[model samples]
Target: MKLKTTLFLLFSILGFSQQNNPASTDSIKKTNIFKLGEVIVTNHQNQETTNRVTSKTMESQNKMEVSRALNLLPGINLTASGSRNESMVTIRGFDLRQVPVYMDGIPVYVPYDGYVDLARFTTFDLAAITVSKGFSSIIYGPNSLGGAINLVSRKPTKKFEFDGSLGLIDTDGQRSNLNIGTNLGKFYVQGGLSYLDRKYYQMSKDFVPMKNEDGKERDNLYRTDQKVSIKIGWTPNKNSEYALGYINQKGEKGNPVYAGSDTQNSLLARPRYWQWPNWDKESIYFISNTHLNDKNNFKTRLYYDKFKNLLISYDDANYTSITKPYAFQSFYDDYTYGANLEYESRFIPKNTLKFAVQFKEDVHRENNAGEPVRRFDDQTITIGLEDIYKVTAKFTVIPGVSYNSRENKQAQDYNSTTKAISDYPNAGKSEALNAQIGLFYQFTELQKLGASVSQKTRFATIKDRYSYRMGTAIPNPDLKPETALNYELNYNVQFFGKLNFQTAIFYSSLTNVILSISNVEPGKSQMQNFGEAEYKGIEAQLSYTPIQKLIITANYTYLERKNITNPAVHFTDVPNTKVIGTVEYAPLEALKLIANTEFNSSRYSTSYGISVPDYTLLNGFVSTKVLKYVSIDAGINNISDRNYSLVEGYPEEGRNFFVTVRFFNSN
Candidate 1:
């Protein structure tokens, strides 16, 4: 009787298991177009696309052109005089200088003048780019009140590969890049080179007014850029890996007209002729990084840079010539050195702890052809600790704090007047402390919620602290640091493995905000902790993949920046609305087509003054593989040739055409 009972129980259990999972007993296999439910370690708790700003994954096409990927992020804008290497990025409500840029854990902003040129590095080597929303993470140190951009480069891989690409745009621009890498025994070596050249391009629009005597408004542009780099890595044992990298880059750019504008002969009014000046920049960088075990790592970087630029103005009234040249050559040299060390500990199974310390020193000097040279030096140190505790399967909390101290030094010498002045009076030291807290909860398998609160600060830059001008509009050597308090909330949900959506709301209260205000013509502006500000906004992103061959992505932002204390004065640096949409289709196994659209609301040309017209841009591309080892991509930009300007004097490119070919070793 006991044997019979055991057999009966076994058979009942088998029948129930099969009933609950019928597919498990079948021989058929199933495939899915959506994998929204799958996530990895690097994926954060804030799943809402609108609640956070992020960089896309590094891939074959984007590796050589990192900015291309950055162009797709929400609420981000780029200002380019002409060259891709001469562009500036602005995000949220801050300028590029306000948002600190870092590479492999080292600050990339030049120390001599504390200015960063985004075009110095090749995007092909990057593994990822992460933007921390409004000082959300203090691990990068002080001076990041607006936010921070961290670029992580590719590490040594086990495979050996070679990749190359060539491209042409419009009638004048051309680009070529190559990458090669291999792993040998316990060491790895990688190298890359890139070259770019472009001639002047004509505007697609008819900017010539019938009554105007001035020449037609052309795109007036010229640019040349080149870069070479090498990296070596060693992994003697399984517990550690070390990498050494070196890179050199140089470029020259020129703009003949008001960069890009329909205005007539505006260049003639300047002291130098309107034949705008040409600019040249060069830089070299070296870095060393180490990965120790799984919980500790460190990185050190050293960089040097030199820049030369000329300014010119045209005055036809002088008649000696259509353009009079008042030449001014400014020379700048800078040295930067920094290090970062990170430690992670998991003493408790359910809790994780992270701590980091960073230090940096910057020395820079500026000189002219006939006059004096000024020098500025600064040093900073920052440290922070963050703890994450998983209270339960449904709840998690994280809290962090950071501190920083900075010191500045200056010196100057005059040659034309045979005089010397101790500008050291403008040098001083400052300190700041910040904190943040965040919480996340999963309500259901397909729904999640999160919130974060943070306080951040930024110090005055070298240009704002010691740059000398004509009069009492003097640089405030005693300027205090800027600070802000920010709050954010986010929500996310997925539907039937077909639609993925996310939304977020954010608000911020800022104090000691810096403003460049002047009372004179050509306004002499200085950095001042002028007043308070309030920012509130909504962000949303929706992505749908209904089938294996089609994907659609769209994002929108409705943000308002205002001065609550002085509502009469508006902060016009950011647009009130922004939208981006993209559709990609895979027609066959090797053919693809993509369409994109970008739109932004009206923006201010001046501080609460002149307003720029709103505009929309359209672009599309088609790609195909002709051979197993080669592919071609063709695209069109500004399909309607819409005329627009991001900066008052700089006109954006119009209706441009481009073609690119890529080759790789199939083996």
Candidate 2:
């Protein structure tokens, strides 16, 4: 449908339904978010640095992937690894390696590189996603240098419940998902399945033909993903619960050839063809909560996660020949197992104390075509303690500390020339002490102020310390852990029950930052921990309900990053400024209309000063109930067909439309 026609019809319906009562927002809040996995402080009190994205918001925005959904929030930026055709995100200037991802409180990042492709994670089976910025709970274990992200699954509150959706995209893409659950008085079971497939995407009309791109449909832009999740829980009593969960994901994608002009100077910047034949992950976990008494409680989590992938590099864009020097096949097999035990007690008056112990082991194996497999193993352990002290009726103070240690047990080096595998030298160990303190004051029933300071650390990943960077880098086995000291202040208030405002300012000082030092050897760079940096940002969010039928929300972020050790270097991926706003109108009890816009400032894409220009995008959607149990949503994204890129050469999709039908039933 044309944009003008769609807008006119929507407004006409709104005018005709003026006499009808406005629909209740509660209708979209049917999903039951799991509470056990939340890492919150001060029991039931909301923190200023924490934000949550609900299933309702995800559905309304048509955010099918985790990375896109997170982009809706302030202080989070969606980034694309164009060369690899992978979607990623950075939180407050911190990459995934510094801020780990978790599913139901269990670590899920890849063991080799400490990164996960957010595009492969679908939102169909999730109830909510929580993000903690700058100041996260120490009980979450180690590696929360910038913050943490947690994916919360759904729980069944009804005897029988089901939710499903099917969608079609203009770019020859299809998506479908199904979720079912049953909740008996003492037992419950939940299961979900989702699939997504896409052939290609069209570029903007304004895009000019490039070396490897023809200005039409993007080449090698195919993807397929399938996921399955299941959970079983038993609540023997009101004070105790245990659950077992499992998830499996399979994905495949083709990488688009580089289309930029900087390929001539750098050997690693050459245009190439690559395809991932298989990208698979599996996880199994068990969680339990038990109340020993009115003043004491215990919680435990045990999990095992596995990852496997195969990459094929072709000689040319045709993807048929592989006889060239760069043509090769690479494979990775990695796995991690972890366990956590937590104990909480309120035995002391006005004080809640918690203690935790965590242990994890990661093993990674990788090999190339006709090469011997090399292996690496690492083990980490953490011990933590925290206390929430109520200084007064309206004031609270939280203090936490943790000791983390990581030991490398084995690292095998492959000598291709001699065809011999030998142990790597200086297989070392590292340890760090993390600490944090937070203070919150309730000015009134509708106003709150908070301040926090934290010191966190992240150990170098196996790839960071061992990989040769395609024969252009040197392995540094003695690399030290990176550390950051973060500070934040925030305020939240509500006015007349119609407007909500939240604002926060954060600053982080980083030391021992891992950077690539050029000319460490004849023509190779080395990863060394000799750099320092600083990151500062401010975020604000506003939500207002002007009338019973209309709601408006907006958020803004301003960030700055500086390389203290070397001002000549630049930070990549994250923008300096971002603004997003949305407007929603409920014309009738069964119909709603939404319009949103996003603005991103220019950002550096390479350390040598390559940048992507800033751009703005508009999107619109309409949702209506067709039946008591079914609803339909139609939307158009990139309404202006603006040509934009998060990276230098990766032009984003142009104008496109999608239609989805969703069904929900509960009893």
RMSD of each: 13.0, 5.3
CA lDDT of every candidate: 0.61, 0.88
- Candidate that scores best on lDDT: 2
- What TM-score quantifies how close candidate 2 is to the native fold? 0.95
Reference-based lDDT, residue 39, model 2 = 74
Q: How accurate is candidate 1 locally (lDDT)?
A: 0.61
Q: Which clashing pairs does model 2 show?
A: none
TM-score between candidate 1 and the true structure: 0.82
lDDT of 1 by residue, 1-667 (tens): 5325533543333332211222210011011100111111124542334422322222322323444455566646554433222555665666666677765545666554445556545565454555666635666677777677666554434245445567776777777766666667578777777777667654547343222113233433566667776777776766445666666666665444443233333332332223323344444455543555465544444444445444333343231343223444556666666665656667667776767777777777776555566777788888888777788988888888988878875545343455564555645678888898888888988888888888888887776766655343556667778788888887788898889888778887888876665663354666577878877787788989989899888988777788755676666545788898989888897788888888978776555555567889898888787754457778888889887766554456678888877554411
lDDT of 2: 0.88
Lowest summed lDDT across 10 adjacent residues in model 2 is found at 16-25
Question: All candidates' TM-scores?
Answer: 0.82, 0.95
lDDT by residue for model 2 (469-547), tens: 8999999989899999999999899999999899899999999999999999999999999899999999999999989
For model 2, state the Cα shift of residue 112 in Å. Answer: 0.7
